[model samples]
Target: MYEQFTKPILDYSIALVMFLLLSPVILLVSILLAISHRGNPFFLQERPGKDGKIFQIIKFKTMRDLTDVNGKQLSDYERLTLMGKIVRKTSLDEIPQLLNVLKGEMSLVGPRPLLPEYWTLYSEEQRRRHDVKPGITGWAQINGRNALSWEEKFRYDLEYVDKISPRMDAKIVLVTLEKVVKRHGVNANNYMTMEAFKGNVA
Candidate 1:
């Protein structure tokens, strides 16, 4: 009942409130990233949402585009700017996603969205993570975030899907705030991001 009816109201109201409250921080980061990259500070890319629907996920652009003499893009660690590092560590990069919530493309709590290219890689069971709208944070995020292996993350995602409720979501949100405050599990094994999910995991 909560998932189908009440959650959407809560998500929209909370996101609107948060966006207004954080507008100053968002604007400040935008200007800083714009100067740092000398280009657009917003990043948008396609991610699978509810029932594997495609939607453009929005975020702050925290990496610079730099290439070697061969013109090949550098690694994520190499492309990460100082400001980017701070923003990512503090999770300010996620501030723009409030717009996604407003657009009804997401929930406040559910499975985190993943790259569209990974759709084919997921087993039928793993694909169940998309049974609900994606979230900016989720069960896996608060539990281990990028620190967890793909299998562990999927386990938590499934658990959430099978047992979603307002109480569970509220607790997840509270724990997520604490996790963000501590900057825990912001990266996988100290890397700038998690390693790409290959089909072998399934």
Candidate 2:
């Protein structure tokens, strides 16, 4: 009952409020990012949403365009601009995704959407994460985020899909607040960003 009706209502209302309240902060960040990256402040990419539907997820640009002598793009660690580091570390990069929530392409809470190219790689069980709208934060995010292996991340995602409720989401949100403030588990262990999931091992 709640999932079908109330959740969407709440998601929209709360997202609207948040977007308004955070607009000033968002503007400030956008200005800084523009100066640092010297291009569009916003970043958009196709991400798989509910039932595997595709939508453009919005975020702050956190990397500079740089290539090596071979004309290949540099690594994440290399492309990260100075402002990008601060934005990424504070998770300000994710704030722009509120636009996605307003557009009904996402929810405030659910499994985090992954790259569209990974769609074919998802196992039957793993694909279940797409059963609901992808979120900006999730159970896996609070638990370990990029620190968890693909297997572990999928486990938590599936668990949330099964147990989704207002109470559960509320808890995840509260804990997410704490985690964000403390700047906990933002980066994967020993990697500039979370390592790619190369598909489940046989």
On TM-score, the candidate that comes out on top is 2
Tens-digit lDDT string for candidate 2 (129-196): 99999999999999899899999999999999999999999999999999889999978876778998
Clashing pairs in 2: none
Over 21-43, each residue of candidate 1 has an lDDT whose tens digit, in order, gives 99999899999999999999999
C-alpha TM-score for every candidate: 0.97, 0.98
lDDT of each: 0.93, 0.93
Error of 1 at 130 (Å): 0.6
Q: What's model 2's overall lDDT?
A: 0.93
Q: Cα lDDT of model 1 overall? A: 0.93
